[model samples]
Target: MSNYPKTALVINCGSSSVKFAVLDPTDGHVFLNGIGEALGLEDARISWKHSGGEKTETPLGAGAGHDKALAFLVNNILADDKALLDSIVACGHRIVQGGDIYSQPTLIDDEVEENIKKVIPFAPLHNPAHLLGIDAARENFPNIPHVAVFDTAFHQTMPPKAYRYAIPEEFYTDLHLRKYGAHGTSHMFIAQEAAKMLGKPLEETCLITCHMGNGASVSAVKNGKCVDTSMGLTPLDGLIMGTRCGSIDPSVVFFLCERLHKTPQEVEKIFNKESGMMAVSGVSSDFRPIVAGIQEGNERCTLALQMYAYRLAKFIASYYVPLGHVDAIVFSGGVGENGPTTRKYVCSELEEAFGIKIDNDANYKARVYMGVDHQVISKPDSSVKLFVIATNEELMIARSAMQFVK
Candidate 1:
């Protein structure tokens, strides 16, 4: 352990993309970050950066899943710096589904890895990709430790009522089908940072943290513990996002099968990939284009945008009752950090209901970049505070790794 680099390698593997980050464990400083994409259903492309501000990109292989992509990513990113790779004492993987098997970041071994695989049925789209990332990293650095930093770990504090559906208890007891919320790390990081900016003790801040990226989720944090969250068992169960149709009635699946004549898996593909604002406005998933159309008199885009805001506001307001008096609202992730109009829209309707309000001018200007400072969007007299906090889950992982290295 003393000989290994005091650095930790972090991997976040999505369905089509693999994002890697290297951080100094002692200080949680990101040395460099990069992504590899398996786009167009063809050969994969890889890219990475060095701390010297040098970046490199190339093709790794074709049509391989995340595991192969991970191997190729290491080859291109760390090949020139064998010493750096050797210094990576641990690998922290961002797993989408932790289920009841884990409540925090756990060191991965043969038994732990097998247990993670057992939860695959609970998160079919996510768990497999995570395993691939783990295997790839282990294959390259077999002696190093690998830890699973679950997206659901931070929400493990959710009490039974908040997590359990109104369905039969047998399903939960026997099949473990209860809600295991995702995006917990993002919610935890954003909420704490927002509370810090407001000079409030994190445990005293009753916050609603919106992690709105391509995948979106809203969490209700009262005193630093997640009480309730928008995303249910999967990332697909939140507000309408880039490609996911969030919070649809369960019966919609039957409608897809009977009325649309599609099988369950086919319908799953639609909700996970083709639906949401893209399907509603008939525009691209990237909100930039959809927002541009808003200025071009596109009624469909306007309606889609309205639905997005209305849905987000509804959930945020609903949690106010469960959380008691709200202290601050925090926004993070791709859209939440940069989409001021979206954040503004979500906050506007809540002004009358939850005493929530934000300055549109500040929001638009604040979003010039994601990691910018805390901008006070709330009015001086407004009871509730609103903020944009940049989340750093990679650093969180590195810090967790440090706790174990000694």
Candidate 2:
């Protein structure tokens, strides 16, 4: 190991899962990475893999919550690697929604913790879990500096016009009701990477970033700042996701309540958990199965894929309004980087309209160069360039956290 400390512990705690990684941010190498999942119930388990070893899984005890799960990870997996643990100088957390108060990675303090608690209403499932992870990790590794990296921090650069809702002013001013986009860290990272790929300064580059996965969102980055994004108020407002009904008419809720006799809670559940590709394809929420179904002559799956691509294309086109000229259209996240068919379909519609022509062979070859680095897929003569960049939210978190410790 180097004489100076060069590692950071990154924590991403979800509603029922805790994902942690020990990384060397300078070289982008993961010493150890793992996740504790199925939290708070029997059969809760922790699985992890070392850099050069096979993955290992162990059953956590019954009723293991986020705190207990993180404790087990630090005590069991990380404790054995004293060198790696000792080299870690900071801990970075992924806070889903920071509301309007936070705009950057903040050092964890009592006031910071309180503000995070205050935003629970905006991120009911995520904020509470993040608090658990933060509390547990702080206690488990008391000496290290801890930082809260808000996913909304990057999009804080969005102007009022882009983030504001059309409701009464008080709703936005008092109730804090407005668009606070998600996947901001991914979008920011990809935008910076795209700037580097173009050999231009980030402050002079303009780009559109598509972060597509189980949860999808697109952002318009003008001169390296987020001017607008697709997701609104919550992650549910973006492009159709694995299960979310993205960007539907607000009146649909009232319609469901009146005609279907569904409660508000029931309607929320349906929109967040029962819609999207799962409902459209009528098979599974996973894209792999949906794509497989399409190959097997399933019309519903075919339509689902088409609709997903269409919405993405439309969003890509609309973002151009904010960014008068885009240097590149970047694809990140799980599906964005790996789903060539989806990428092909999304670009096919924009080919003539946007002067973007995909090189089919280059698109297929790009999958081979997925993580950290990016691969360009648009033809040389195409007016607009297209690229597939693997997003590294953890690395971004680590980099932010490192600044505070320094």
Candidate 3:
């Protein structure tokens, strides 16, 4: 291995978006960060910025796709700055589902690529996009090593009891179906950060990590290992999110199909794309607007907020049964870091029962933009601590890739 410090290029691809970051893993210094969005659409565009520099957005004509967009990022963006491109040592791709086959980051090869393709059914919306970005990056930079960092890897430590669904045995044995949680990267990152803040070794720490955003999930981390998580089999099984109706009863699907005369695919679309906050509030899926609607005396919005908070609190309390004694409850991701009202609402009922009193003043200050990514929002005398930590999945992916390169 070379002694010189080198940057790691991290790629995260969604159905219609591609986010890339180049960072120096040793010091966590991001060199360049950008995204290409609205792929294949008339309004497709790419936006990027150098560290400490103003952002630049460029429109890509209607035919632009992932490969074309990635080429632009490399040939037009990084190529303009040769030094930065030359310093890149490896590439890391964030893969959503690795299935039971991959329990850790694996160096990508023909076999690994085939395995990734095989698991596409488990992550229909994510894995294909990831493969596109992976293939594009590999072709764009053929010399460097590339790694696939799975979002489901960290939660592989979950016990069978926590992951197993009470379904037919053949479904699991033949199809490899079970509750493989999502947001493992974010959950693992925050759990370690929370352990550091608590002045305890990760192996001895117990934490409840809430990764709340447009997509949300909570994990119970016991002594550095994941015990249980809210999301299961797919991301749709988690807490209520921007569009997903998390943890709905299976019978609801039957009702939609048999009673309402809706097809399975139609019901699936409604649950995954048209429900949750958007369905309940009938205003917006975003938390800010939902909270605003509550303040404006919208009953549906108020009920939506209450239901979201109640479910989150219930998950937190339920995890306590497995953890026995808790050290801290960590709030991370988009909404968790900025939405103090949501945080307050989530802990409202648990304050007395679980000793999770939120320090209103401190809770209101934990915003990523304010340089306060890590903060303790719990009352000083409270038995259980509460923290808000910014989740850094890209950095974590970079570090994971570094281990293989080194």
lDDT of 3: 0.91
Number of the predicted model whose lDDT against the real structure is largest:
3
Worst 10 residues of 3 by lDDT: 1-10
Angstrom error of the Cα, residue 9, model 3: value is 0.4
In the range 256-368, model 3's lDDT, one tens digit per residue, is 89999999999989999999999999998999999999899999999998999999999999998889989999999899998999999999969878777889998887777
Comparing 1 and 2 on TM-score, the stronger one: 2
> Can you rank all candidates by lDDT, best first?
3, 2, 1
lDDT of candidate 2 at residue 183, scale 0 to 100:
89
Error of 3 at 364 (Å): 1.5
> Which stretches of model 3 miss by more than 4 angstroms?
1-5
How many clashes (backbone N, Cα, C below 3 Å) per candidate? 1, 0, 0
- RMSD in angstroms, all models? 2.7, 1.5, 2.0
